[model samples]
Target: MRFSKSLIILALGVSLAACSDSDNNDVEVKPPVVVTPTSYEFTVTITNLTAAQPFSPVALIAHTEGMLWQIGNSASEALERMAEGGDNSQLLTVDFATHAQSAESPLPPGEQLTLTLTTEQLESLKISLATMLVNTNDAFTGLNAIDVSSLAVNESLSRHSHAYDAGTETNSEAHGTIPGPADSGEGFNESRDDINSVAMHPGVVSQDDGLRSSVLTSQHKFDNPVAQIIITRTQ
Candidate 1:
């Protein structure tokens, strides 16, 4: 009977040892996890350089490398809409543009306006800015598809924006065709009036300069480099 008791005790000891070893072998192991952060932001300040020509609400876009208006290519319908009427809604809704904003109101000559934008990545960020020359037909000014990916935080850059003639309208300087206060005429007519491709603007010749039909005065005449834009990366 004592031998039987000893045998039972031995069996229990073996079972307990097996359970402890199994428990140790069943332990779980896991690796650390990592995540990447996203986002880039910046600001643009625009200063009008013309004597009297007010700029329409400026449209600024941060896109993933795409042209808004090529110098020799035809302007898109969205560009045509904004270029003719100073309306930026359609331009901001373009497919390639990831972020966009428009200035609050007309930027008068000699005045300054600023805007801000953000995007998920900055490696290939391209910027496009545009505004109508309120005193001329189809005349617009601003930079197009400028690469800003290399700009570092708090770094700054500045460039003069030359005027461009949106080939959508004629430079007739006619009374009823002007959209600004000088004439209070129409904006964004569907008809294609001028050359169907983009080109540098030819300065306006106002009524004071013997263009009797032109509603603008000597104050509205302008030359190249109509405005200056400054960009500063904030993030």
Candidate 2:
């Protein structure tokens, strides 16, 4: 066709534009990119601050909801087990826990134990721990659902935990009622003979303090701020 040069160029430009549109239509649409949550790790160290009380293996848990024990509430069987007998198996396997860790051995007076936990969840993340004063009847000390979501990587927090009575057993300090070395007595009895509600432990009354039947001597008595806990976000 004998078209003018300007008209020919215009037609060529139009054709190229159409071709580019066709090519663009043939390009496949890509799926959206998925973002994966990051994993975080935390190190928890527990130190016994008591004079003679040794702590049972500690139960460390990371969860979004719920606590191991609450004041004025009845103790769960899991809490009772740990508080009475120093058994942490039940607490470590609670249904609400996303991740959990346990100390390998009992923490003696002036000793400390470190445990670690990792999880991908950071929203509403909470940390809780529970351990028995093995010489007392259902007395435990630990953190309860302490919020840690605000803690950034490498950040740390420290708290001093007080002793709590599981209220599952009486603080008789009797011959066979305590599981610690002071008595070498029984542990984790399926009995609820005490108040059956959690409350601050009224420091123990030992033989020297007029609780004559108490297998615990003056050395076994303990007061508040029984343990010191330090938490660090490692990753």
Candidate 3:
């Protein structure tokens, strides 16, 4: 009887040890987790300060390098398209721009428009915007690649922008060349008929002033600081 009991006890001990070994072998080893970088964002607000001139839908770009237009330099074909005709499709798709956006409609006098853009990083970040003054011939207002890398989230700054002539088209202010409602004429002519370098705009000479053939009147005239731009970092 004693011998039979010893055999039973030894068998039970072996079974328990085998179950313990199996439990140890089945322990789980999880793989490491992966993480992604957060996005940085900015918001831009543009207000037309002109009394009569309306601004075309703005082209807004967030880029690491490159500019929309540079003073004394020849205007790019994309810029000429916007300045001459208020078309911004090409400017938004430039190679150096990482993110771009456009306003939905023309910003009328005294009105404002806001837009937002986002990216993964902020090193060497710049903001550039361009919009045509619909009442003028190839005149535009915007920032040329303003460096905003030092701008902190929730911070803001304002710039009172002056007008610039694309110099691709003459400021003829003729009956059929003005694109605004004053003339409702042609826009974006491909010919580089004027001095082919960008420069500060000379105020428009309307028919009321001296240009007899001018389709524009004194009401369409504007001076420096045609637009007020405010930039804010949101995230």
Candidate 4:
């Protein structure tokens, strides 16, 4: 009986040791996890809300940092080209840009154009747009360096754009200096003859107003919020 009891104790001790070893072996030590890159798609729509003015080809830019134009500062030479001639090559090449697109055709009055851009990262997401008021000299309507990182997927934001002066040329509205279908005159000159600082447009005082030499008419006049912009995230 004594030998049997000793044998039973030994068996119990071995079983307990095996169970402890199995429990220790079964414990899991997971590895650290890694996150991958996430991509996003952005859609921008611009509408010409003017009565008669036809905007030039629209320029859209997605950048990480830096502004295309400022309200109280002098307009960049690139902005001058876009505001004066409806050209956007230089503006697209602005530093820190991630993606860019331009409308193939001008947006006429009450017309809208939609553009899409994609990015992998959301940090420093910025959007800019510009279009010439084809009926005026050195006049443009758009925004510069609008932060869009806060926008969520499938969500959208809207803004009413205000007109701005390039401050590089005088608003003479003369027969030969104004561009667009209204005049088809000179586009851009290196001269800075007007107020060198950018400001809100004083609006076109067309011949119907007080500027008798103005080639523009009442149809060329516009007020604030000349354009409507909507941005949506698809991805």
Highest TM-score: give the candidate number: 2
Candidate 1 C-alpha lDDT tens digits along 39-120: 7888999999999888999999998768779888888888888778888898888888889898989999899988998888
**What are the TM-scores, per candidate, against the unseen true structure?**
0.85, 0.87, 0.85, 0.84
Give the better candidate number (3 or 4) by lDDT: 3
lDDT of 4 by residue, 25-132 (tens): 677565768677788899999999998789988888898788888878988899899888888888878776788888898999999999998888788798888899
Model 2 per-residue lDDT tens digits across residues 112-159 = 989999999988999999999999989999999999999999999999
* Superposed model 3: Cα runs more than 4 Å off: 1-34
Clashing pairs in 3: none
Q: Compared with the true structure, what per-residue lDDT tens digits does model 3 show for residues 1-235?
A: 9999999999999998888778887775647676668788888999999988999999999998888988889999999999999999999999899899999999999999899988787889999999999988899999989888899999998999999999999999999898989899999999999999999999899999999999999988998899889999999
Better of 2 and 4 by TM-score: 2
Q: What ranges in model 4 sit over 4 Å off?
A: 1-37
TM-score of 4: 0.84
Q: Model 1 Cα displacement at 26 (Å)?
A: 9.3
The candidate with the higher lDDT, 2 or 4, is 2
